[model samples]
Target: MLKVYGRANSINVRKVLWMLDETGQSYSREDWGRGYRATGEPDFIKLSTFGVVPVIEDNGFVLRESHAIVRYLANKYGRTDLYPADLKARAVVESWMDWAQTDLYAAARPVFHAMIVNAADPATAVAPTDGVKSWAAQMLRLEQYLTGHGPFLAGDQFTVADIPAGLVVNRWFTLRFDKPSLPAITAYYDRLSERPAFRTHGRNGTP
Candidate 1:
């Protein structure tokens, strides 16, 4: 059996759990982070030098990073729709995955950190409006992408690309405040909401 190490409420860990559920793979989860299974402990640090939640132990292989784990599972199971076999198609999906971690999260992190971790109100970007504008601007780009690019992120089919990016949608939509109206993104969000895995792990206000 596979072993997943992370807290249940962590958004990143939830990505792996959601993907596992989507793949119909059975795995055991461990409670880590916060007060439970502290990552700073020497034992856990051997698997993850960065001391982050969400480390996967499969057979004798140890891997960290949620997105990498998602891709590994999709490839291991030969789930072509999720990871794709065609070079170009896989590239397109991978592109979105990279973009989400790089551009999307970069913009959203400050707002989320301030709001959730710092317990500060962020109806707008509290200090500098740049973070809020940047995140919203990224969202507008997504709206444009989904305008023609959906029923899913990479295409009409649900893919691994949607796993990481969709979680961000949960964070954005679940956060209370006025947002620029994004019809296409809203519809795309509705599409994600229909997934059982997404509902259970991605969108239930944890992020």
Candidate 2:
């Protein structure tokens, strides 16, 4: 069985957990940086110098980073559907994965911090900023892409792109704010919501 280190509340950890669920990979997970897992533990630092959530050990090969772990697991298990075997096809899917970490997540960060972290009352907090502008613009871009792609981000097939994307889309919809809606993105969210794995971890209702 694979071993994963992270807490369930972590978004990055959720990505890995969701992937494992979708791939039907069995894993033992340890709560890190919360509950019982002590902070600055030497054992964890040895596995991941960055001290980030979602470090995986498959057999004896240790790996970190949610995106890398997802790709590694999908490839190692010969799940070519999730992680495409073709170079170009894989690149297209991976690009969205990167975009989630960089562009989409970046766009959502400040607002997330303001709403969830800095606010006095998380339930009613809505921090106004241009972050929503950038986020909505990017969502519009996503709408255009989905219009062409019809269903998935990279192509017709649901790939690894959807794993990372699922969490972000969940956040977008769950985040309480006033913004123009993207029907395509909403439709995509509904499609992803149908998957049992996604329902279990991706949008388990935590932002």
Which has the greatest lDDT?
1
lDDT of 1 at 151: 84
Clashes of 1: 0
lDDT at 118, model 1:
69
Q: What are the candidates' C-alpha RMSDs? A: 2.2, 1.6
Model 1 C-alpha lDDT per residue in residues 96-174, reported as the tens digit of each score? 9999989987888887777776664455534336667888999999998887767888888999999878888888887
Cα error, candidate 2, residue 16 (Å): 0.7
* Superposition TM-score, candidate 2 onto the true structure: 0.93
Error of 2 at 93 (Å): 0.9
Alpha-carbon lDDT, every model = 0.86, 0.85
Model 1 quality (TM-score): 0.93
